[model samples]
Target: MIEALIVGAGVSGLSCGIRLREAGIAAQIWARDMPARSTSSVAAAVWYPYKAYPEHLVIGWARTTYDELMVLRHDPASGIHVRNGHEIFPWQVDEPWWSGAVPSYRRITPAELPAGYRDGYVFEAPVIEMPIYLDYLRQRFEALGGTIEPRTLASLDQALGASDLVVHCSGLGARLLAADSTVFPIRGQIVRVTQVALDTFVLDDYGPSGMAYIVPRSSDCILGGTADEGMEDMAPDLSTAEAIQARCRALEPRLGAAVVLEHKVGLRPGRPTVRLEREQLAGGKLLIHNYGHGGAGVTLSWGCAADVARLIAQA
Candidate 1:
């Protein structure tokens, strides 16, 4: 039997741990932080493929993840909700490249467009409550006989002695762990607020404010955000949070009175493209790289994990 050691306890690593255990492989996760404290916890977590590349692979992975999330949505405790939403544009545009991945995707009529938007698409996508969802995933992974230890690795080589395989899901830590210079941070800031009687999400990727989105969950709503490339500060900015609320309120007036809950900042692991390939270590152990998911980490989690399991099985 092969045992796998996975790095990172974010969505990607947890998802991979579950898949590997399901595939009859013993898996353990070691990470610098637990799921609740990882960067994934800061995501607004709507199921749209954002900031991931190589269109063909991203579409496939996104579609697969969509299917998985749809299944999980059936369980009330999963923190997954399939909600109606709009992705409005400031100018007339064709359907999105990821339109096919969504089962309920359709161009909204001009009458449905919000003020100041010329085109939009309405779709039903999963809006994940990251806090609850991460807890759910942690429980599910542990239920499957997998364990997650809080440990930080100085390099990929540190885990090779304990397992036949090391699966790298380190996200931005890949820059140092995998020695991949292409991995950089796409800084994002979001403000969480009390649910403002808003059930539907509103996304304005090309709006005047730039990349604003409203993701409503079971309890609260997540309003976000900024995509400042190469920005690395994890500290939440007061002005940025104010700007985010202002942009979200412009989209949905009800948010104007929404009570503020908390503010968060996360560094999305941006890369030219997601790295999901295998490598041979010096001692005949296998190393699988599975990082640099950018903003689509949750959107691509299960799909990438399934592929990672396949690679280990074949090896």
Candidate 2:
């Protein structure tokens, strides 16, 4: 049986497994920890990916995956559902910016907002409880006979010898293995709060030219801070955590003093461009590199994975 080894069990890695399985290929997803421990899993897991990537393949993949996810939204086991969402902008984005994918995205009237808020927009989209969603993906992968093993791999030689073909979804791990210095870590911290009142997701157009959003999943709402180009540190910094809270509070003064469910941080893998190319290693090992997603792993997974799969097939 043809087999592939996928490093980093994040969205891209699992998507690679899914596509390969559908194509009648045998694959396994290997990671240092559980797949959910990946940096992509830290994502708020909102569906619409603004400024994530412009790659034609990546964009198409996101749309395909999101469409498929929409189907499973009604299934309680799926961990996905459509909720009314909001994006509060201090100013309007260009008309072309709307692209009509933001589900009824429009400026809110003064009557619709609480006092002190100028304007906002509303839309309908899928929100991901990533903890649950990752579990769902793992079940599907395992059911398909895709094996997952946790091993700390330090070199490409280790990966080259492990499987017939390797899909490097290693995210930041690609830097050392792929010898890709262009890929670096973009740190992000978030404070999760239990806000039952936060029924909808709020996309905030603020925080360093607008990279932050308050996402309400099942049990907790996530407030984010994007600290790009930082060393990888999973532990949360109180200063950064406070800034995230302050930014989110501006979005919702109503949810005052919400309990801090948790505070977590992760480093997003960033490259000048998302690398989705395949190469033959020194030992004639098949290698398809698929990392550098930055903050859009969930958003770009299927699109990027499809392209990675095609690149392999063509080879």
Candidate 3:
């Protein structure tokens, strides 16, 4: 009967908690903020593998997570919606590197391309409403008899003696707590608007204007975003929000009349590559590092969690 303490209550920590508990380990989470307040809540979390590194491993983790999300979509309470979407490119391109992960991936014909786009691929991907989905995860983790508490730690050593194992899913907090200076912030800003009768999502990662995407949920459409590398400011910039809305509206004219609902800014935990390995400290305790997901935190959550559980089993 091994007990584990996971630091961070965001999607990664919650997902790891669920997997560990299902594997018969007693897992509890401690974090500075709840799911709703964590950076994961601010993501325009459509399942596209963007901004994580070490391409091969990221694709593997993304594929596993895509399948998991697809299964979760069957449960109405999971807040996972499989929406038809296309990622358009400004120039001609071949099939995406992650196309195999998508069950229904296909290249769209020229007739389906938006003006000025030369190539695109369409697929059914999960568009998650973070607020609802985070709550769903929290509830699911709790129903498994796992506990989450509000706590702030000055260092990773603080969690060492409380449990047999400590898993770090602390996101950006890892930069300081784990003393891993490679971790930095990739700031993103997004705008939420009324749904505007849109069903499909549109993503233009390499558009001339910047990284523009429209992710429509059941109630609101999430329009974004900017990937400003090395930016840590969390305050939503009014000009940036306006630019995001403008770019989204250019891509989808129907959004022109959509009223603004809210503006959000989040600092994504960025690193050269995701850190998902284990370390042994003094006193025979185990510490597993699982942060620095950058913009793919939600995209990589389940896959990373499964790997974490496997590591625990082998311990």
| Regions more than 4 Å wrong, model 1 | none
Tens digits of per-residue lDDT for model 1 on 110-181? 888878899889999999988889999999999999999988888987877777699999999999898889
For model 3, residues 1-315, the per-residue Cα lDDT tens digits are 237999999999999999998988889999999999999999978998888988888888899999999999999998999999989998999877888788898998899887889999989999998999999999999999998899899998788868769999999999889999999889899999998899999999888788799999998999999988889888899999998988898899999989999999999999999999988777789999999888999999999999999887787
Clashes of each: 0, 1, 0
Which tens-of-lDDT digit does each residue in 101-192 have in candidate 2?
44455666777664445667777778888888888878888888888888788886676687769888988888888888888888888888
Clashing pairs in model 2, backbone N/Cα/C closer than 3 A: 61-303
Off by over 4 Å in 2: 55-57, 96-104, 107-120, 207-212, 281-284
Q: What is the C-alpha lDDT of each candidate?
A: 0.91, 0.75, 0.91
Error of 2 at 153 (Å): 1.5
Query: Model 2, residue 90: what's the lDDT?
Result: 59
Badly placed stretches (over 4 Å) of model 3 are none
